[model samples]
Target: MRFALLATTMLAGSALLASCATKEAPVPVTPAAVVEAPAPAPEPAKPAPQLGAFGFDEAGMDKGVSPGDSFYNYANGTWAKNTPIPSDRSNYGMFTVLADLSQKRTQGILEEVKANPNSKIGVAYSTYLDTGTIESKGLAPIQPWLNQVKGLKSKAGYAALLAQADRNGVSIPFGSYVGQDDKNPEVYALNLSQSGLGMPDRDYYLSADAKQVANRAAYEKHLTNVLTLAGEPNAAARAKAILAYETEIARVHWTRVDSRDATKTYNKMTLAELTKKAPGFDFGGYFTGIGAKVDYVLVSQPSAVTGIAKLIRSTPIAVLKDQLLVRSLDRFSAVLPDAFDKENFSFYGTTLSGTPEQQARWKRATDWTAGALEDEVSKIYVAKYYPPETKAVMDEMIKNIIAAMGRRIDALEWMSPETKVKAHAKLAAFTPKIGYPDRWRDYSDLNIVSGDALGNVIRANNWAHEENVNHLGKPLQRWEWGMTPMEVNAYANFGMVEIVFPAAILQPPFFDPNADPAVNYGGIGAVIGHELSHHFDDQGAKYDASGTLTDWWTPADVAAFKARTDALVAQYDLYEPLPGMHVKGALTLGENVGDLAGLTVAYDAYRHSLGGKAAPVIGGYSGDQRFYLGWAQVWRRNFREPAMRQRILTDPHSPSEYRAAVVRNLDPWYAAFAPEAGQKLFLQPDQRVRIW
Candidate 1:
């Protein structure tokens, strides 16, 4: 199963360049140096502010369009029209902008570190950039692993090979990971779920849409290319067999919506029970091969596991080995020869996502190094770029949001007093981790060879797997974070009962320190609220304040919550991003809840911050109007058609335009914009749905 975290779902981008200038040695004699006294050092140039005068980008707004008709366009129409998505990107916006800035900063850091021979990050990065070495090495580094697959004698021997694949970061029939046990949040547990599909989601395999059909064909061709490059005979036939095998797995896979349900998906069983439930597969051998010592495991999708295990038993041994080989080649394509990298990207990037070009090699190398040594890079990133004052401001904002949520909960008429008490307890218990983790992850034991790029990658994967396996039978590491400090995203981990904000997300449209109070509130302030509200959203509500999966809501509370959420789903289902593609309301319900509740509470918090005084108008716009605009501008994104279609099918968040339209559900928005009854986004007062 996926990690129990609700993220903002924003795409992260890369950054600019930095260089160090060397100063010539000063003259030994002062008299000789005085021959040309340097002009008074020029006053340092002031850095330009990221946004407009008060944080809102007024120039980006299209005032000709009424806020009611289309608030997103009214706020960001001009910017969207002028800002072309980068050729290497499928979509671009504020998140991408900030991500680019973060990556650029990271690039500078890597460059400095690369000069140090002992720096693991430097050695790893430099090795990845050595295209000549990579080309010369070819498949020599991974040949042993491929040969191991070829040496498999029977279906029973596949368990060990699959375990080795997991360590090397390759896809397998079943995916497993260590996580906080939902029912027992204090102890880590092993989780098993259905996997093996090459596409982003099961929909990609099952959907009969013309685009999906074309994607499947492209994927098959990509597979053939990879197999042929690996010197495998009958590559075309093997590719066809692999696709057929995956399609069978897809038929039994759980839908994203169903898999996300905390109550329905949690099925804990002993080793004996698992073997019995899925009799054909080698459960014991697989667990032992991975060195997992747990007596029991959490089965995310019980029926899917059974179905997949059966398929593993029924599929030909040759076909299974072929699938593993293709997956392995794709996984290490970056460190492999250029042909492997290009073919892998040709399908996954151009065909699946519509990105025209690959990101620069150095940028890709920087990303890989950061991911491989997340904390090492993050520790440096935080020290060089993140300031103490930013975290302090964010801390205060999170507290205010939590207080505002408390007030909202107290005022809820649908919730019973008993349930409200629990809600308050949960709110009070939320652990807001801002900027970075309290302690850094140690990577001293992980080896990084200077010239062996593939070897470094493989070792890093194995080290990470060992780290996760070591977590079993130990207490949860509360200081650990899922995101690095350089990532331009945030998440709410339900099991940990915490909301984490990385250092990189605290700039520009998200949370500029110099921006207006309203803008900050709508930007990061609302983001804080969004993550907090996730704990009370449809699926998250199943977990209690203790971070244990259980029913904490009363019967009446469930009914009322569902009634409101059902209306939200209906509202989103009507949104058509493409000609035939509409938002998956049921799949995206939780995020929609977060957007609605987050914005609503953020508005209340903004009003409260003013101490009941009327907000002053700025630049011919009221504070409420600016607040809404801030929310809209942050979601200003333009997506390529193919990418947009893929997101509609798989992503849990609604399209950016519809997400901005969430303002229509709030009563204050109606007062601020006075959207007429006939406008496209106008909602009747009673038609609005509010739940937090």
Candidate 2:
């Protein structure tokens, strides 16, 4: 969900901006009479590097000062030190600019609505923000619902209610009901993702490695403590309820590795087939509750669904309401967003060349574009904003990125030759989706009328739920894009073997040609590597080239990979940013792996580009050295306590400080940037995690 927002913003970046020029403005005529003006005909042909072009800089490693004093560290560190948190923003990062801008626009809208008390959007906002005070109905809906669920005296009845809640609470449209699928005999296999801690993915909770698991434990405790502050004053009773809720939900919160990519390949199953696999449960009602208007649903394993349904019918409701299940859903909805933002600020924000103003314009345009006016928006954007040169740069960047990925695959050591071949085949099969989608989502059915904020959210969510539910038993649309076209971030779906770069992130500090290659590599190129590496991350590694959730790793290699990943988890676990908050290395292992592997691949690519020739001055540091600095600078951020706490519980990536420190500590390339054998910069030796 954190990445979803990031992806949305990224997609919006490519949308058309509204025309700035007024129709009435007349073109100024050049003066024909001035003698001095005539002399201006021979204006000097000033030589400057073409926009988006970089000139080679020959700077060898420049390491005399401490790493804390490095240019990039100083620039970002200075900002981190001085920038105060704005009241409107919960967290601080480059995207803070976007949020600030959004707030300004939203405030303007709010003011307009306030002036016109009858406006739809105004009413929606008012209602959503009311906290139920308007009608003295604070959480009344929840109370009734809870009571209905609680009234189920029998275990069978209670189990049905719990299953309903699981469906209701699962944040993502596709992931609910996975544990009940008939395919996996291990009922809880899909349910492994739940834990009370507010973070993304189950790996964050279960991994016992040094870096992430340690953080996971601390994060869990800290979050529980925070919740205590928000819970009922009757500590013991509240604790009992919470524990009751947590473990119950965790039991049913199924895990689906790379769900985005794999969704399309799942076949559909009829209600009769589903019933046979898992009897006693009312299959028809469950489908109806899920709003499945269609006859069949896309099922990765019809067998699993049937099996899970059987388990639901047989298992006691108490067992279904396991603490892990409740916590998993709660965390998925609440915590994942903050975790992603904290880990890679630039990945979701200023990594691109565009300004916040430009991004805001893009987002508004894209949101509107997804409606009936999509063609109009696309045409306008292509004609007015999508420059030929920009397209060329994007095309070239994609080519280089894909090529670099091939090189990385060829260089893998632990992978068996057979697996490497398969990896290459997957890479070859990979699809590159850049900028906008070929098919825009069908938003025609959505009605934005009656702008009651609560109504609007409910309608939007209902529409989404209906859309997902309607997919039952239909052929998967391979061409369907998971993210909107104008989002601000990029991602790789390992199941699909596809990488997507939204229009939002293709600009600025991340991609302009004027910036040094070292910076670009550290910025966007490393990001490319990160996404590419996700195909091999702990979870992503579970999915094979066919986009199926099956193990492909050799037994020995899997063990070794886990060991290497475990070490990364340990390294990050020790980092403590606040009084009680700590990084959950297990939760962040995938990202941590991406950070390390991305940097490694990008650095290797950069070195290969130079043919191994040492460079002599980039701001007094070698090109190689500056490359790493540029990487660290991308993650520089600032945040307030509420925002920081929120992110700590939810996000999968480490904090910005750790994003830089943790990755660099494990990277030998960073040592070149701060080449002092015993310097603090070299916190860990290469031998520690020599794995690719």
Candidate 3:
């Protein structure tokens, strides 16, 4: 499923930006039911702020820096300078801070249930933590899968094997999943897209840059390491052949920017049409293998699909089988012996992302358990850590942000009245889901054995695939959510016309109930506005209020929107995070729009919350100044050079520093700091691009 996330990071897993349209009416904005903690005794006075005296971290600021010249530095320069990205992490920021906290909390939850025989979470966690057992088993668990790959006798079996690999959660040349159709929001449809690259993007294989070239070499070495560990014959030669084969796959792959275009990617076709268009490979046998009984499928990146199919038919079966073997080995490396896990991390972590060390085994186990049994973990998470009062507070804040968006839409000068009406309708139709889902996913059928980590993961993957397949011929489950409650991220699902806030993201820096009103507005309030504005962003503008992908805008509206977004793209294009690499402005335009509009509306909401009364000065900073700082601090981050470079090519969000600099486009930000004419980020009033 495609999700317009608040931020994109490898830590959050791969969230391909796409839309999932839903037919359900807008659900009322309300807090989910929570297992409330025992009420605290009434206090005589209010509690202290969570972050600082007034919610902003004054010590983190650099007073020597001019806000206009470098607001991000002014707000977070001291913090960024002193703080180091964790040894096991590619980058560190507020998001990482919270994610670490969530991981610890999940670990605690697992500890409490590890002895419970009926708890799948317990069994999964304990089995993963059993290093001696894993070491003893060696490669025994995955030997059968390897044998299947080695047993491949002809090209005729390619489609079925690839489909089986996909179902078992192994990387393949192409992938398919069941999601709500873009055009038909009411029904679930099978979606296929190009896949198979071991690297983050096609650029890693195709780019001429020195860094990318080095990355390719490192990848091949890593492949050989895995192949040798798996006891393959002529490992080095096979690894080289596998890399050459994948480079061809990368050549046929679509660029990340083009793949993000909903209109271009959404190609509905009959089963026969798919077979005819990509005839070399057997599409029919593949669907049958996946257990997807659909009359038609939505092919994302049709050309890439066709190209990959042709490549599959032409590539040597031995090379293809070798690739599949390496993929399978690497996919389950963590559950394998220590050498395999460390080898996997050496390339993916140190070489690609520049992290010096791997995360602790227990932490990795906790994360895996939580992810494999997400809702089950979340059910306990929300009951313990999530405060019921926090959800209520978030609900009201979301409503305010939604109201703020409505005002912004009504005040748009470039949009025609016809377009404005639909914009308002869509805004009104937004379903804001706060904290957690109202309904929990049932994992009763999932079997997690105590001593079989590999088998458990495979079963869980198959179970998930079956769950997705079951969506076919059934009504859309409106209560379904894309993220678990323990995640530190939030998303705007355009197809559902809903904004989701996971329980874990609601904490210090993003949202603090004890913090000042302005800070909350600038932090989570802006986040809410960001998610809401996504429905009105460049691609999102194509979908109407009902979540149908259509052109509801007039020609003038479309042109006007593009004119502003094009300017945003150009503006971001000038930001050089690294010496030779610049931000991909077109690729990040949707998120940039979200930041610009979200911050603008959030400022408006903060002012409105004051009820026309002047905000009291705290720490000698005015209300607006504190608000802008709040927004900037939330994006405060430090990244390793390699991770920063990789994010430039693969991630949809701009660098955190650039994200914080989004304040340059706002008028209130200028008034708050009074940046001068010669300053770095001082955009002239007329030069500012504003679109809601």
Candidate 4:
């Protein structure tokens, strides 16, 4: 996956800027389930049968669904039909199963901590229990923050308020993160970008589509409920005013496409220069509050950030206070009272994401504790689940795949030799962080107590903020990790110029150690290829071997790459998940590039693994057939219609339906399935994209 570096705002993205993603978050909404959502997941007592190395998943397949018609359904049709999406989830598939398994282990750790709180896990566990006290406290926890907001009578104070909010990990007018300077790629620097919206994407405010209009209406009601609960006056009218402010902010934002371009967003300026360019907000005070030491900051989307200063200044003081109060309530409501929690779920869970019910409190608390004390929980997770052998095996697999990518780059006809030399240098320098970070993050300073739910989270957030910024003026910690061992996701860091596969993602169906080479190559093998390919994707390609965001490509090679990416974009744009709702081709171009490259290289590695011997037939499938199936099984998803529709609009990844279609771009897929003429998936040989 193209790793999105940690930023001040990861809250809402209608599209992904390559190399990053926000941890899952909920937005306020209404209770409008068109089709009744799935029921809560049933807990089975017995262990599931271990997937075999070579045995076919006969039950997983739909015999009648032809591979040529739709390979995703052909491989996963039976499972999709039989399995219901859990009531607490918007979608469920292979990844969800792995996540649920990891959650089960994480819960065991938290439950132990809850019973016996101590130095390491005590704070996170006690904070989890604090939610029980939230009802009795009854908005008292946020009263201090509310009073502070109300007292912000001057625009000068807005900057400080944002600084304070940043300590608690909340998004305000803008967000900042400590990352490598894109130009220097050696020392850590503070990066700021446009933010402060209550909605998930800027387009939610700008789009005239019916779904956006209805969801926006639901959001207005959601804002009203949250604000009214917080004891604010004129909740409905306040929501209207807030929406307009966000809409204007959205209008000025660099489009999602522009945001994805590294060359476009990397505008570095001195603090003094920034003040002159975007003069209303107090950078001097803001920098002081945040303890930023950098002489220069990278202002991503400068126009949008500058526009934010204008919005903050032009808006009335009362509206600004209301904005802070309402967003705070929306953000913290899940931990507040039953009413607040339920209301939060009504919209974000049901209306927007199509989850029918909220998860159990313990489950929700489990997530919070995990976030607050990730490394602490991960210490236990690694011991209980991830063995040393797994990491060793993963290391071997990564080497094979990287070697495969190296060969492909050497053979690229479109790339000039000059670009290939630099690309090769990058491949040689490519680092892989598998299983866990060499260094574990300390949460000693993050305060957590039994009764103060809000304070505990704020302190935790502050600890996180301080930890991130503390790296300033120091060498970049190349061994540092972005995601924890317990996180069931992978990332490719453009800053560190590395690929990370967390311990949790190392399990089957992504990586079945016991499975045959073909199976492993198809599943986790594709994921590894995907992350490596990200380094060469539109965004990652701009960065040099040292991780600087500098172009090393010859002009002729750059044009050829764009021509291919343009073709890839047009191919994906044709896929429509909902009426009039096609996936944003340009918005998802980087990810599409990664997906195409990852799967292609994975197939090549699998062939290389064969070492000239013909592939063996496993059950009824050939090696090639199982390879495609392995890839297909990874993306086997069952999504609620509304959730599917929303993801089509917002997620940088193409819909699961089309993610399976990534196989269509590969030549082996046609050869394996032999997609004949007139088949829905059939593409002429000349039309196939072979960019890897």
Candidate 5:
């Protein structure tokens, strides 16, 4: 959900992977979770309804609760208390509603494809849906790759195998891509990073915590069980060797906090220098085999690339090959036979995410179809669901929000005039990619056959690899989007100095054409402000408006800015979402700053929207109250304990409960609903942090 630079997940979509964490599979896909809503003042309320004017229900509020005390509870307490997470989903909330809507719509499109079979969308959708064929064929499809791994001997052969896997999309050993040059944002640069780990993160392998230690044992057993299922003769020994190899690789991995820092990680390297830096690895053959046409690459983790290469040279060829085999199995088990699916899900799903059951096959297959042919799927989706008028409205709102942020920057007291000038330029240069990309990804070369699910995926990955490689030395597609149109997510591409809100998020509680100006401003306005604030966050501040990663702040201004941010960090560090664990203030600083500043700017924009007129009360609440309620509705979420714990441990954003608590930073929120002391969320005037 952070800047989705060059990393690729299962569908090869744009992603921001943990620097050296297992890129192939993170703990589970991140789920939604909370913030600002109003408390009930002493008044006879109107007839309570299940939902409000739009889909954001006013009845979700717990009237008995106080706002300054716990706005999350006051706003979403009833919803949290009543909403049950779906059995198949580890977490559920506002995002899930939009996601389900998109999924259902996509399912209909795929179902049409299933009927047509000859159409382009149909061909892509049907590829992953031929489950009966998959179940009957069992491991026959991927067996060739496994057999190839079994016979791998020379280091060149191993490198070739890894490249082939990467090209074909079942890649396990570190991930590679071509992205914007951090130093020179206009040009495309190839990148390689640390990947190919069995567990979710390096901490799982190296942490001294007892729970993590036990999870490691379970992971090993899962690997052994999987290898044994694949008929490996010495499965137990191979598992041990594979674990040791991964552990060594993990040792050199960049920590999550360090990984989030763009300045520290972006290392431009020539192909020859890269070879020397990570000696013993055959990057030449790998690049040649993969058709990666580039002289230089943006190596995300130099130590990792070289360290894994060193591990490759020191470890026996068989063990290294076996690790590939195991990782391959883990990566593809979702589309493989039922046996593979059950085994893979048992650990990654049940043990890791704590969902009790797997989603139905159709849902999985449909989601795969959505991801696999997202360009085409998005095209169809836009034509059907997204209208031109909606885009026009979103564009207008984005412009308004930008104006609000610019006004805030012009008025900042801590930032020097020089820094403020740069900030204004950066904000003015901001490009809002609302709804979808101006240019679509070309999937023309990808061969999508009805029953060849594996073939379809491999070709899709190859298509992406080729596309990235071809971008070398070419001008950047500045208007290109990282997410598909149907995705229920938004991102701030710091390197591009742009903000993207996918078509899906533009609908519902996030943005509604029919909702009052206050509601729309509170929802999508906050999103716009959040992304805008990210530009001034610790990492984004390094990059100037032109998208170049250069310092634009005076030393004194930067120090003053950090001093304020440090207060924000310390405030969050005190939040205990789970017992015995605390939010990592340093890690989530950027996102926290985003939430805090975003809300502040959104509120300002809301008043600006009034054009100096009094805001009309709607739904028995005043305009300011409605604004806070709408903002809180944007974050409504419920998660299982396991998912909650996982999010706290790995996610850069604070927990949903804490995200809602971000209101404590703003004085206006306290003033709108005056709160006395002894409330759960009350903070002294000095305790509040202001960064904008």
Candidate 6:
């Protein structure tokens, strides 16, 4: 989704300035007959509520009724029955606002393309954005580029292609390629996940799990589709080619993860060692291509060294032809800013935090979002919006959530004793980053235009990129944060044992000092728990306690986790957004697991924090009920369908409605509040899946 990048701020007008850059419940408690009484009437099949109707006039009576409820029929009742998933989205949410705004902005830009109609950049973007033709065919504008890749016939052709990428400032190393880092050695990094492998991990390729076997079959099919789409005529031959190329890439990819943690411990390294370690692949040429000047390589995964050695030996020069894709990939990657801006305006500009005015003001305030932090504007912004009281509350909430999670971990009967220890250690290792950065990033070198919108943006991004690449060779800047202090998002990076909640998100619907602790705990506190739970989510559990990406869980624990997650995936996959569309549950399992765990742990923390205080009434419902309502209210939003479709294919998070509905459906505490028999939003005792 498009929006501003993490780090600094940009005014919407400033955003508009760079015309060229575009690139930017449950029932419970009551014994058997209470639950059975609700069972006889089929729960009245409450008609699904409209996305806008989720809120009630009361402060907390509208718990499950809030907008942005679950997308699934089972959870959302009548709302799912009547509401249709927009043709353009797989799921829907506040993101639709952002998407619509971007479309309008892009449409304005596109109108300029139509009016002036013929600059190189305009033509390029028009060709890329022509949805009528390209979207139907899955980015068909790249067909000619794909043909060029097909034409390569020899190792020399491959070398020439690599040289071209270097000339064009692209960086490709086996599986992924990034070109912008040519000037800053610290900027280069790869997102190890989402490499388009059907198998869960490299281990699946080498394992005997029946599911893995099926995944291999699916991988072959998926590769066949990609190759065919790329112009390969013979499915069988294309599958072989894709398999061979991917296997080699996976060899390198797997190695990088094998020892990522140890490598992150120290940043001192020589270029000679780096080159010697990963032979065949030309680091000097690659580094030169990206303009990176690293004192030491930031080996995020220590195991990357292992991959370097294996890639040096096992990879064949013949297989290198696939690297030709890197150039186009780099170009596409560059366009991410454009794509993101066009898609996620609401997410970045609205929901996460901030009004359009605030967002616009942010742009003007901390104009250099990417390059520097701790700017005067940022400090002021924090002081204005993120008060010390909120920060203190957040710190306490995190502690409570973590403690609650630990209590849950202690109760896991399925986990082995050894696995539990590792889990606990990982939990302990988690470093919570709340409010703003402890140390602001240095952006003195990045020159902001002050008024030259596009120039300022490019400079800021370039500076940030440089900072990232320079992390190589130097000690791991444990304090170097990834997200801006003012950003509205929160994140859990397993590699770093870090969880971040920026100041922008610490606001209404998430946290309110006057609100009951249950509500706050259910809202932002759950967000914290959700992030923390990532350490043990489906993909996260693969990583070991030290925050290294590894397989530390026992076979049984792994099986149980998957068994539960698989059900969740299937349940979500069945939710048809449009007539024929459904959410890809597997793609979203990691976040879903986090969502489930977050709500559970947050609720537990609330219960413990209450210290036996009676549930006070606020607005018509008890405080217990208000907590759920507060949680739902936070997600209250509406979306245009066109944008919703796009999110389903790309976003990992479920629609806001489903995000709330599913959690409430699984929340054991929800039933305690709304125990009215035969009411909708009540859950059967047998339906619950409590995995925290």
What ranking of all candidate models by lDDT puts the best one first?
1, 3, 5, 4, 6, 2
Tens digit per residue, CA lDDT, model 5, 395-486:
77788888888999889888899988888889889888888777677676777777877767767767777776787778877867789888
Task: Kindly report which residue stretches of model 3 are placed more than 4 angstroms away from their true locations once superposed.
Answer: 1-43
Candidate 4, position 653, lDDT = 88
Better-scoring candidate (lDDT), 1 or 2: 1
Superior candidate under lDDT, 4 versus 6: 4
Question: Candidate 1: which stretches are off by over 4 Å?
Answer: 1-49
For each candidate in turn, give its C-alpha RMSD to the true structure in angstroms.
12.5, 14.0, 15.3, 18.4, 17.9, 19.3
* Candidate 4 residue-wise lDDT, 1-692, digit = tens: 12244334223324322432556564544445334434545554333325744523657888698877888889888988999999889999888888888888888887766756465465556565665678888887778887988888788788888788777776787879988888888877888898877777787788888888998899889988888877777889998988888788888877778887898888989999899888789987788788787799899999998998888888887887787877777678766777888888898889888899888877777788888888888888888888788887888888989999999998999998888999999999989998997777766666677667777777877888888889998876787788888888898998778999999898887876557678789888999999999999989999889888876999998899988998889898898878888888998988889889998888888899899999888776889988888888888788998888778767788887688888887777888888887877777888877787
Better of 2 and 5 by TM-score: 5
Candidate closer to the true structure by TM-score (higher is better), 1 or 5: 1
Model 1 agreement with the true structure over 1-692: per-residue lDDT tens digits: 01234333443443333343547554343332223333555554444457997888989989899989999999999999999999999999999999999999999999998868889999988999999999998899999988999899998789888998998888898999999999999989999998989999998888898888988999999999999999999999999999999999999999998988888889999999999999789988888888899989999999999999999989999999999999999999999999999999898899988999999999999999999999999998999999888888888888888999999999999999999999999988899999999898889999999889999999999999999899998877999999999999899999999999999898889888767789889998889989999999998888888899998899999999999999999999999999988999999999999999999888888989999898899878899988888899889999999899889988999999999999989998898889999899998889888776
lDDT of 5: 0.82
Return whichever of 2 and 4 wins on lDDT: 4
Q: Give the TM-score of candidate 6.
A: 0.57
lDDT of candidate 2 at residue 624, scale 0 to 100: 71
- List the candidates' TM-scores in order: 0.93, 0.62, 0.93, 0.91, 0.90, 0.57
**Local accuracy of candidate 2 as per-residue lDDT tens digits, 1-692:** 01122222222223333443768766665554433212223443434322222332222112333563343343365566566655333455654443344334444544445334554344434444443242343233234443564356665454345435544453311244322222221221122112232344343445454534554444444434433432324434433444333333334444432222233334545667656655756655655556544444445534444444555555555434433233332322111222322222221122211112223332332243232233323333434333446556656555666677678667777667777777776666767776666665655565544323223443555566556555544554556556543345778765466777765465554555566777677777788778877877887777667665676778887887888888888887876766667877776788888888877777777666666777547546677766776676566577655445545655777788777664444455555644455654455465456456
Q: Tell how far residue 661 is off in model 5, in angstroms.
A: 1.0
Candidate 6 segments exceeding 4 Å error = 1-284, 291-377, 448-458, 664-670, 673-684
Q: For model 2, what is the error of residue 243's alpha carbon versus the real structure, in angstroms, after optimal superposition?
A: 6.6
Candidate 3 vs 4: which has more lDDT: 3
